[model samples]
Target: MFKTLSRKTVYQNRWMKLHEDIIERPGGIEGLFGVVEKPDFSAIIAVDNGHIHLVEQYRYPIGQRSLELPMGGWPEQPDADPLALARGELQEETGYVAEHIEQIGYHHVDNGGGTMGCNVFFATGLTFSGRNPDPEEADLEPMTLPLTEFERRIKDGEILDACTIACYGLAKLKGLV
Candidate 1:
């Protein structure tokens, strides 16, 4: 195991913190590691009948728009309840609220580089109300598609968000889809 000798914040913002660490390997060799510290997030698979709701938004970092599951973290409330976050994200992004929601899985975003984990939720019995998106998500678009079409989009490399793909796969294996 690598032991952290010292760590310093290289940068910090409301949403994330970047840390540079000095680590000692088992053989007594010292090396540097960079880690991104972020609040835990939630991803929602909002399903109704045979369709799934997803959101498309422009990801500035990637310089493109992405179609993915409704997911987000409350940076100001890092320790917020995962279930609540999932439900809120689904409604905020898709304008649909679920009558039932449950956690299907949990996983780290990037074990090698980040301290962010995601709670995957399976939601059903949805009701359409209206969206209340954050200002940053002003361009977000919501859509509902058949599960098979979603799979096809992933297979075609059109859906590239790791969290969305992993969460859906886990939900599928657990018969939540």
Candidate 2:
């Protein structure tokens, strides 16, 4: 097993940190591992009457307004329950209160470099709730497409967000939504 000898923070912010670890490899060789430490986020598949709610927003890093599931986390509160985060994101991004929010599964944000991951939830029985998006999501637009269309978009490479696609796939495979 890889054993950590020491860890040093290389960079840090409200959302995440980069750390470098001095390690002993399984075969006893010494090496280093660079890791991004981030709090877990949550994604919600909000479904109602054969449709799914989606939010379109500009993602700064990619410089594109992309359609994706409602997702977010309380970065400053990493210990907070992911289920609560999912419910809040569903409400904040879509203005839809879910009468039932069930966690479907979890997925890593990026297995190669980051320890961050997300919990996926299947939300049902949505009711109108006033939008109160986070400042970062001020331009978010909430809409519903048929669930079949959402699947088509995924198969066509239209939905590029990894977490959104992974979480939705899990919900479908697990028969949660």
**lDDT, residue 175, candidate 2:** 80
RMSD after Cα superposition, model 1: 0.8
When superposed on Cα atoms, how far off is each prediction in RMSD?
0.8, 1.3
Backbone atom clashes (below 3 Å) for every candidate: 0, 0
Off by over 4 Å in 2: none
170: Cα error in model 1, Å:
0.3
Worst 10 residues of 2 by lDDT: 168-177
As a TM-score, model 1 comes out at 0.98
Q: Clashing residue pairs in candidate 2, if any? A: none
Q: In candidate 1, what are the lDDT values of residues 1-177, reduced to their tens digit?
A: 889999999999999999999999999999999999999999998899899999999999999999999999998899999999998899889999899999988999999999999999999999999999999899999989999999999999999999999999999899887
lDDT of 2 by residue, 62-174 (tens): 99989999988897788889888888888888999999988878888888889988888899999997889888777999989998899999999999988888888788788
lDDT at position 73, candidate 1: 91
Each candidate structure's TM-score, on Cα atoms with residue i matched to residue i, is: 0.98, 0.94
